[model samples]
Target: MIDSDLPLLNLRDICKSYGSTPVLNGVSLALNGGQTLALTGESGSGKSTLLHLAAGLDQPSDGSVHLDGEDIGRLDDAGRAQIRRDRIGLIFQQFNLVPSLNVAANVALQAQMANRFDAAFTAEISDRLGLSDLGARYPEQLSGGQQQRVAIARALAPRPELILADEPTGNLDEETGDIVLTLLLELVAETGAALMMVTHSPRLAQRLSREVHLSRGQLAVQ
Candidate 1:
């Protein structure tokens, strides 16, 4: 069972550096269930790095990251990978879908890998994301919006505890991006999952419950 009082994600004095160049310095934050946090920053502000640390994709050079009360930084590579696979959902601006796979297959891929595929849940997510009719189509067959929907569906299919989205709607027009953002937030709300999305758009960030700004490797609440 998930602890409601405890933060779903916790970062404490997190720091990262590439060689001698510091990327993130003493960053800390907390996220609770069903909370949506928009991480806003200019280019090279370490927003992506913070997300990667939260996802356990990269280890912090100093400090700790706790997900569900477990210190992810202490886990081994395989362990971290398993945690990422099982507990975190990641959405990228590029809409990283397998070109050959149809929508249904791509959406079900992670659940299949985790051996937690649920046909009913998958169907529900597909329908909710407006991908029900396009399940048989390949990634190339879809438009930018459609492809993004597929990515969102895939992320939610696994029922992860946390969702990390990096510029999820960056490539789309304002109207399309708004639609996608609405859908994504609705899904996150329905699932009661924690979400931290990196975006440069202040308008988009305003939709979230809270906003955090990253500037020169430091985090500031906004």
Candidate 2:
């Protein structure tokens, strides 16, 4: 049964491979509620792959992934998707927003799907993200930083228990990245959500509660 006492996400001896080309190996980690962990590594170091496994977007070839005490690896596609939609928030470098939806709709999309939408909360997040004036704008109408802010608002809208972010600030200027990171940290803290973010920026990683380095498909505490 899912329980609050359990770690939000736990990975044990995880491994992944594609046609004998191994990606992750024996990567073990656990994240608890209200904690922020930074995952850092070079390109091809398997940071994104590890994030995917944690999010249940893919299964590890060996070992287990537990989210809220449920073994995600044992779940069928539909079950995993349900957990992802309802409990986990994801932010990626691509900032996947529906072009047809305006900023307001985009921000509220996941929350609505999760059946946790709140008009006041959505408006509050948009205003906090500096998106209040841009609610009617589409993705293309916004700058990179603005678009990423929208993505952040969308992810946090549901007040999820866990947040998995992959280089969410990778494309922004240093100042904008700092702003986004600050807001993300602050919001997650306010919501008491566990966070595991993949970032290449050492400076940014320093802000997290913990940091781990991924290399050659393995993890080392930093």
Candidate 3:
């Protein structure tokens, strides 16, 4: 069981730098269970860098990151990879579907990697995402919208506690983007997972609970 008092994801006084150049400074944020937040900032404002830290893909130069009560900054590479594979779901603007795998295989990839594959849950999410009929299709055979849905299905297959999305609809047309965003939000709500999405558009950011903006590597008012 999860501790209700602790946030699902937490970052404290985060700082990141490459050599002498700093990308983030004294950044701190928290994401509680079942809450959605929009991470917005201009290019090079450390939005993606912050996301990478939260996802355990990279370490902060200073401060700590915690997910589900585990301090990620202290975990080694293998441990961090496990956290991502088992506890968090990620969606990217590029979709990032496996080119060699069929739709079903791609959707089941993470669960299989985590050794917690569930055929029924995979099937349910696939159907819910309208990918049931396209299970046999490969990534190259699908449209941009379809591919993004596949990416989402792949992310949610493992029943992750937190979902991180980076410009999830950036590649689609306005109509398609709206449709995809609606479906993503609905599915996220159903799963009761905390979401932190990075988007540049205010319209899209407003779709989440609240906004966190960055200015010159520092947090700004919502």
Task: Give me the displacement of residue 197 in model 2, in angstroms.
Answer: 0.6
Worst 10 residues of 3 by lDDT: 179-188
Give each prediction's root-mean-square deviation over alpha carbons. Answer: 1.8, 1.5, 2.0
| lDDT score for residue 101 of model 1 | 97
lDDT of each: 0.88, 0.89, 0.87
Model 3 agreement with the true structure over 48-163: per-residue lDDT tens digits: 89988999988999999988788988888999998899889998777878899999999999989988799998898788767999999999999988898899889888878888
Clash numbers, per candidate = 0, 0, 0
RMSD of 3: 2.0
lDDT of 2: 0.89
Best by lDDT: 2
Q: Between prediction 1 and prediction 3, which has the larger TM-score?
A: 1
Candidate 2 backbone collisions, by pair: none
Please write out the lDDT profile of model 1 over residues 99-164, one tens digit for every residue.
989999999998888777899999988887678999899998999878988887788788888999
Give the Cα-based TM-score of candidate 2 against the true structure.
0.94
Off by over 4 Å in 1: none
Candidate 1: Cα lDDT at 122: 92
